[model samples]
Target: MKKFLEVAEKLAHEKPLGPKYRNRRLVGNFKGRWECHIEPGWLLVYLKTDQEIIFERTGTHSDVFK
Candidate 1:
């Protein structure tokens, strides 16, 4: 999970992640949140605000979304 932590740390600092992470804003019911691919099938979802960055979930696409 080291890579995941690294990405999380960057996010907590409000730093922009590289394109390899495929980071993007979420929409639909998940609006206001953000998602990024941590690996081939792994993903991280979180919400960021001025005060804090709230990690929502992390898992494979199906694992987290389903």
Candidate 2:
């Protein structure tokens, strides 16, 4: 999960404005939250605020959705 953290850190700074995070998008039914693929089946979910990025969840697709 180290790589996931590194990518999440980079995303916290760059957000949707950067090409590296092109796949990031807002999640349905979860206001202020966004989702991004970390690997084939792993995902990293977070909520962005004016001051900081708050991590909400991370896991395989099925595990995270649960």
Candidate 3:
């Protein structure tokens, strides 16, 4: 299997869900125990195994958890 970060990168080539979340950070709602953060401001999304951005959203300045 691939890590979260890798998954985010593959999203484009494998299953790109672009524009759908441009300028907005949509939660992946990943059903796992790992913690991730969205970078809502660069049109790029990411997930992390520990603390690295896998996919980032480039827009809103709010915490999805908040």
Best by TM-score: 1
- Our tally of clashes for model 3 stands at 16
Q: lDDT tens digits, residues 7-51, model 3?
A: 466443545444433423344563332232233332333444544
* Superposition error at 36 for model 2 (Å): 0.5
Candidate 2 residue lDDT tens string, 1-66:
787877777766774434544455665676568877777677777887778888888888788787
Sorted on lDDT, best first, the list reads 1, 2, 3
What order do candidates take by TM-score, descending?
1, 2, 3
Please state every model's RMSD to the true fold in angstroms: 0.8, 2.6, 11.2
For candidate 1, list the clashing residue pairs, or say none: none
Worst 10 residues of 1 by lDDT: 7-16
Where model 1 places Cα greater than 4 Å from the true spot, the runs are none
lDDT per residue for candidate 1 within 1-66, as digits (tens), equals: 899889988888878999999999999989999999988799999998999988899999888888
Worst 10 residues of 2 by lDDT: 15-24
Q: What are the models' TM-scores?
A: 0.93, 0.72, 0.22
Model 2, residue 26: what's the lDDT?
67
**lDDT of all predictions, in order shown?**
0.91, 0.71, 0.38
Q: Which model, 1 or 3, shows the larger lDDT?
A: 1
